[model samples]
Each structure stands twice: as structure tokens, then as C-alpha cells.
Target: MGGGLTLDGLNRQPQIGNTRLQAPIGLAPFNSGMFGQDGSIGTDGLSFYRSFCNDRLGLLCVGGLAVAAAGRANRSSMCLDRDERAHGLRLVCETAHAAGVKVAVQIEHAGRQTGPHETGLPSVAATAAPCPVVGGSPSALSLGEISLIVDQFVHTAEIAARAGADLIEVHAAHGYLLSGFLSAATNTRQDRYGGNLERRFRIVHEIVTRAHAAVGHRIGIRINVHEDLPGGMTPDQAIAGLRNLRTKLAYISISGGMYTRARDVIIPRRTLSRALWRDQAATVRTELGVPVMIAGNIDTPELAASLLEHNVSDVVLFGRSLLADPDMLISATTGRQIQPCTDCGQCKYHTKGYPHIYCPFHPTLRPLRSTWKRRRTD
Candidate 1:
């Protein structure tokens, strides 16, 4: 059943921020980064999300908003560090509420995956270990810096609450700052924030605790169940760490892989089998007994229905497929011709050279890139 899907919270168990969706399908905040230069939701970003809401999608996770400028994955990403940022977020809330759809703001920090050219400051991470893919010499964060970051996460959550966001999904996957602290391949520290699985999850625990204190039950998280790199986060470790947080969150969104193996992990290719993480999500649902959301090669309604029917995931997140075809949900429900996504890499955004995401097949839906400056790697 697509209706009445619930994501449990501490005080209010079995409720997704007190909102129900028309279906189990939702849009993943595909980091388009076409927001305003000041990291606010500009006209383009609002219109983009509005189009999806009009398509009758259940939930919409707005594009990842950096907690601070230094944590930005790229220059074009929106930010939630200041009070001014709330204005734009309010607009997004108004638009989604008008459409009777719930929206979540995905808050994130890039960590060592970003560089000074993009953030105008040295990238920071759990350790000095360079990102396996981005290959930047990021400075390891000190105790004071880590504390400040924890506060930033809390402050941003407060802003989201004030702006009327139904939930704030903390981005703890895809080799970002929180992901770095959780993975053994990247985090090799002896402090409380690193070492054993529980210790490594200290910062995240602090963030979640403080966020809940500030914003009640509007906090959720997306975490990697299994990183692709050697000595990275294992499924067992993920389950153990999530056990520590299963009660504090509104929901747990399961994802796999760091940026090191982005191809099949983050964005699976067509050749790979669909629902790559189906078993992982099912395991999480059985063990943690908390609501779970999953995404990966879930391109059609039939696949999504099967996952929900089998109790694999509570919500199904669609990424590139929706980017390729915005009216995908409507087309599927109304028995219309649904445009197939070829799994083409053309819509990948925030890459070094390519600054925007646009499907060549749907030229009219392509976001305008007139203001985006080409990123300089030299």
C-alpha cells in the first residue's frame, strides 16, 4: 500500500513527522546545486521542486544544504548556516505544503571530498587521510573544531524547524564529514570521536541529541550500510551504530558506498541488478524495528511496490529516474507513457567540469546554467 506509510520517532512512534504520503515513492535531493549564489533557494530551485510536487510525489527531500560554507561540496550548494537562509526554506515549505506533500531538508558537510577553491577554506575531516576519490589534503579537525561542527548541525536543525520543514535528514553517507568519522578506512583516531564503532559515532550521537533537544521529532538521517572501500564501514558495523540511534531519529534512510566506488554504490549502472540494497534494508527493518527508506536502481513502480509489499523499505527514494522524468509518478499512476531513464551519466551534477544536471532526452526540463561558472581544477 502506498498510503499511510510511517517513520517512527521517539515520542511519536510510527509517524513520519505527523504526515502521510500519497504513495511510498519520494524524490531524493539529487544535489543539483543550482540554488542561489548566497546558498538560498532561488527561483530556479523553487521551480524545480514545484514541478516535482505537481507530479504528486509523496515526499520531497530538497537538495543537500551545506551547514557552512567551508563544508560545501561545491560553490553552488545552498547553505543553512545563517538566519537569512530560512526565508528561502520557508518558500520551499509553502510550495510543498500547498501541494499537500511533505518535504525534508537534507543537511550535509562535504569533509575532505571538497577543496579550498570551492569552500575558500581548507577542507576538514575525521583524519588527515585524503579522500579516496577526491584526493585532497584535508586538515584533520581538532577537538574544538569538532565541537563547533556539532553546534553547527544543531543550529541548522533549529533553522529548519523555524522554516517549517517537516524533517531534516542529516547527510551521513557518500564520504561526507559524518561519513568520514564513521568509516575505519578514513577515521583512524584514538579520541572519543573515533576508535570503536560506538566511539566513531560519538559526533553523530551528539548532533542527533542536540538536534532533538532543539527541534523535537523532526530529525532523520541517511547512512551507509556498507562502504565499497577496503576496511570501510561494514553492514554489521552499520547495524550496531544504528542500534545506538534507532530511537532518537524520525527515520533511518539506508544507503551504501562512499565516493570511492560511486559508480555502482551511490548511483548504480543499468547493468547492475535492481534494488541492489534490498537485502540490506530488509535486515535493518528486522533488526532495528525502526522505519527505513531505501534507494538504488528503483526506476519503476513495480519494483517500488515489490519492496514495500515485501516489507523491505518503508519509503522508496527515486534519484536520477525522476530527474530524467519529473512526471514519472503521475505517468505511472495514470497509465500514461512513462519515459524510461537510460541510466545516462549526463545528468550528474557538481562534477569538476559539468556544473549542472540536465537530461538531454528532456531538454525542456534541463535547468538553466547561464550563471554557473565552470569549475577550475588547474
Candidate 2:
């Protein structure tokens, strides 16, 4: 309404690269702790099965899944490293695909943000820089090591494609290993991997190009369009940076915050407005002329409709809302009032550090969780 965009126009399916999504709604990736400790399939696939069974579910980004053992994030996250792990991923994707849901994984490396308890490997970053929030001095990665990491990204994409993943989201955001190279605060390397925009974004360029070559054009990239730190890249600069690499990527997903600004990205503090990055997403969508996806606190269907009506972005990704009510899209379409997410931040807390994620506001989803766990483990 505000920008010559109408609800009727917005309701139409938009093409992302060569793929056409049924609707603009997407399930954004997080450390959902829905996988096993060995980074394979978890027992919660039944819940996901029910949640994603509807035709209204367009695309789902399954993870900020660990791309390598060295970058293993938490104890119970999924990975694309081994054949056995891919088997679990294949089964999960098969289930989703059977129900008409397309799945993608947000492949990532934790960089210096990894915990010693998580991966048993020393954290590595672009310039031996330590994120202020993470609080550790990381060893600088050598050129050979950086190239190897890029190769691993290509290999991961190949495995993900074979595992029936419809798309691959290269996570270069939120202070991960790739984002470390993108941000000035975390990247101080004097070599080609740091300083200025092009050099710093070299790894991402290589990954997107190589991964797309390996897995076709179903490759996307997620980035922190806004970083509220002194030495971090801001949303405006990030837009320009992305524009430079626009031709390489299939789509661009706009996210914000870094490890230091975790509250804006991971936690989504109440002080911040819902859809906090709406305008930034619009800019990316307009300037770069690509399919743009935005996920922040934009949880409600009304807001999502309004965002599309105004041409804010191409896709609206709901995080905590899906956690609260897997049937949210059905409720929205049926004009039934959907249960809202309390946004207590508890789900994020539980998923990142624990193996189970349930919405306390919707406790009936797992009435006898203890029994469910006993059955799964036994």
C-alpha cells in the first residue's frame, strides 16, 4: 500500500533463482537442538513432521548446521561431514519433501565463537581476533587452511544436495567464521583475507561460486545486514558489499547482529521492535534486485502480510512462532487466531545449550515429554 505494492501482488509466488516458492513464508534456521549429540537425526522429527505437513509451508532452512568438525558449534547440532550423518539428513529431508516442504540448511563455521567443550578443537578466526562476547584469543588461519575451508564448503554443499536438500544457505553472518572475515572488528589479517571489502569477502565469494557449481543454482547467503558494534560492518555498508557479490548468489537473506550484538540476532530482546530489519531488507531487495528473505521478530501473520503488501522483502521467515505453533500457517490461512509466541527467549536458550526445545506457552505439544524421551533413548 505504501510503496505501490498491493496484497494481491504480494500473494503471488516469487521466484528464488530457478525455484518458485508456493508462498513467501519460510522457516529460518537456528541451533534448534533437534538433532542427536553425534550431530545426526534427533527424535523430534515427528514433531517437525506434523509442523511441516501443510502445503502452506514454502521453504525451511533446517540449520546453521556445522560444516566441519573444527567448526562444530554446540553438542547437539547437525553436521554435513560424514556419510552416516548425511543419511540422517536424507531421511529428515525425505520426510519434509513427502509433506510438500522444501528444505535447506544454513551451513556455517563458528570460527572463534566455538566452545572448547563443544568440538574439542581450538577456535580459529581470520586474524587471531576474538569476539568481545566470546572472550578468547583465536589462532589466525593460514592461507592454505582458508582454502581448505572453502573446499570443505563445496564438499558440504555436494553432500547436502545429494541428501535431498533443495537449497544451501551459506551462513556468512552473526560472527561465524565467514562473518569474522566480513567484519572489520574480527578480521585484522594483513593478507588477502582481510582489509577492505573485496578481500574480506573473498571466502564467501569462493564458497558461493564453488558451492553453486557443485550443487547447481540453489545456493543462497545469509548476512548480518546490521551490526551494532563499533568495529563491525553496518547495514548500509553491508548492502553495498552484497551488491558487489550480487551476481554470484541465488538469493540474499537479511539478518542482523553479531556475537557482540547477540541480543538483536539470536535472543531478539523485547526492547527491539518486531521486524526490526524490515527497511534494510527492502533496500537489499530493491537495490540488488534478487529474492530477499527477512527474519527478526516478524512473527505475526498480519505483520508478514503487511510486509509483503508494502514490498518489504520476498520472504518472511518465522522463528519462535514456528516453535510455539507448528500449525501457524494453517491457523493464519483459516482465519483462526494462532497462539502467539511469548518470546520469553527460553526456546533459544534451551535449543542452543540443551538437546530439547519446547515452547512452555504450548506445553500440551509434549504432554508427557519424559515418556517421549525414555522411548527415544531406550
Candidate 3:
């Protein structure tokens, strides 16, 4: 009668790994180099996250920090190793920490997906192959080189840990380096890192286990249960790999598609089935003993809540939806109309050359202003 009311009913506390997220709704890594970095080389990046992170959103998948020079998606992206360039990343972690929001650095290598124009380096992959989108034959990683890349991921996780991140997510999805190794269409090797599920997933398995060994209970994975390529790893194969990695992982987020069929990966067209990976995630939760998260078109709060209620997934993820409205979770909890994502799919295209992720419905992101002279004026 006297105090303020609280929005209830939604399950706010969903535990993933050792970190208990304040809400079941988590912000997927929106885009690398475009949310927080102001003074960095990519000056136009990294503008909205401090406020976005401060919002009711729970998990923050802060991308942009490349594990090593070879992994750099572009020059604008953040690097965890360089102490001088640590400001943007530290700001992200500190901001999330202050808000009691869990943060995970989505450490990834672009692999053959990145072109020389972006990283000033030749594209590399699980094998010396070319993706459907990029040109120039990628240098196949050697055994020693593969070991070195694993070291890079582990070191980056260590950097994230010291930077105050709560978890480390290995980005083995969306046709990245590790994903290539796991896909039959990509990897043609005969070594331990190739062939069947166990061998094909050796790299990711090593990265997750080693990162966990380094960071303890703070390591997880984001992977495609099935790559959309015709000859790629199937859902059955992907599920088998997840089964083995479950013990080593704190949690897993399921995604699909590779670079060739990028639309299938991000689901640009509306005709695709919504919440594409929930079924597989449900299987993971029911059969395997791993906490699973499903991301795709589970846009509305009602649907997200319904999915969680039915035990389809342990966590509900929003990418494009939240990019349109950062406070979608708050609106969902409060029974307000969650802003609908038009799904025009301009955000992904924007990331191709531009340095921002904006909803096609809302194209412009107004930088936060300060009445007092601000540090962002640079």
C-alpha cells in the first residue's frame, strides 16, 4: 500500500555454470568492436553497452576482444592481451560488475571467414579451404599451430578472468575456426582434430577443458548443433559432440549454419522456423546433463517465457530483438509490449564493413550524452 510495486512472475534467477544470472533473458554478443570502444582505433565502436548493460538484461556476451593477432576479425575489434588497449574491455566488465550482471568474453577467431582487408592477414581455417563468401585459399593450421591457437584462447580467457569477467565462452559457432574443425565439409585432416565427432571436436574440447582448467567453473561454449552446409556436421553429430563436452563445459548455447549459408545461421528471412534450436536444446537438457540455451527468433517475452516454462531450454536468448530495444526484458517482466524486431536483417550487413549493430526498425543509436563536458568528445 505504501511502497513501489515489483514486476514478478517471470523467472529472474536462472543459474548457468557457477554464475546465477539476475534474469533468464540474456543479451547475446551483439557485435564485436561496435559497443564500447571510443578511443580505440575503431573509434566509432562500443557506444551503447554501458547503458545496455545497466538495463535489466542479465548476461552480457561482450565480443570484440580477439585472442591474438591472427584471430583479429578486424583492426577495430578489441584485443585482450595488450595492456594499453584494455580500457574498453575493462569498462565493459566493470560496468556489468557494478550492476550485478554476469559477463562473458566471447573469445573467437574469424578463421577463413575474415579477409585480408579486415585483419591484414591471410585467412586461416581447420583446413586450407575457402568459405563460400571469402576469397583466397586459407592456410590450413598445422598441429603446432593448432596447439598455439588453443593457447591463444586459453590466454584470452585468463585475460578476461583478470578483467572481472564471470565466464569464458569459446565461440565455436557460425563457421569460425573451431567450428570448421567440427564440420565434415571443412576439415579434411586425418589427425586427432579431424574425422568423427570426438576427433573433429578435439580443438574445441581442448579449448573448453583447458580454459576450465585455467579458470575453473567459468568456461562455456557457443556452438552450432548442426552446420547448415550440405556436407557439414549434422544435428546428430553435433549432439554427440555436445554430449562429450558437457562434462567439461559449465554450459552451452546452441546455434546453427555456417558462412556459406549465413542467412541460415542468423535467420534473415522470416519464413524460417522460430526458436530454431530449442528442440535440440531440450534434448541436451533431458538426455545429456548440460544446461542448454537456445537462440534464434524467440523474440517476444511471452514466447520466451513459454519456452522456459515447458523446459525447452534453461535460458532464453535474444539478439536482434534486444538490439531494437535494450529494455525488452524489463518490458517483458512488467507486462509491457516488448518492441518487435522487424527482422529486416540490416544489423548483420552493417557489421560487414560498418562498426555498429542497429535494428533495421531503429537504424540510429544516439550516443549517451552528458551535460557536463564528457570524455566521449574525442
TM-score of 2: 0.91
Model 1: per-residue lDDT, tens digit, 1-378? 345432221011125645566556778866776567554666766777787785356788886788888898887677789877778778888998898778888899999988887878889999998876678799899999999999999998888878888888999988899999998888999998889989998899999988987898778888888776787876678888878777778888888877763555778787887888889889988898877888988887667767777788878888878877888777766789887898767666555465655665553445464454656441
Q: Per-residue lDDT for 102-164 in model 2, tens only?
A: 787778898888756567778898887666766677899999999999988888888888888
Please estimate how well model 1 matches the true structure, expressed as its whole-model Cα lDDT.
0.78
Evaluated at residue 16, the lDDT of candidate 3 is 79
Clashes per prediction? 0, 0, 4
lDDT of 3 by residue, 169-216 (tens): 888887888888988888889888987778998888788888888988
lDDT of each: 0.78, 0.76, 0.72
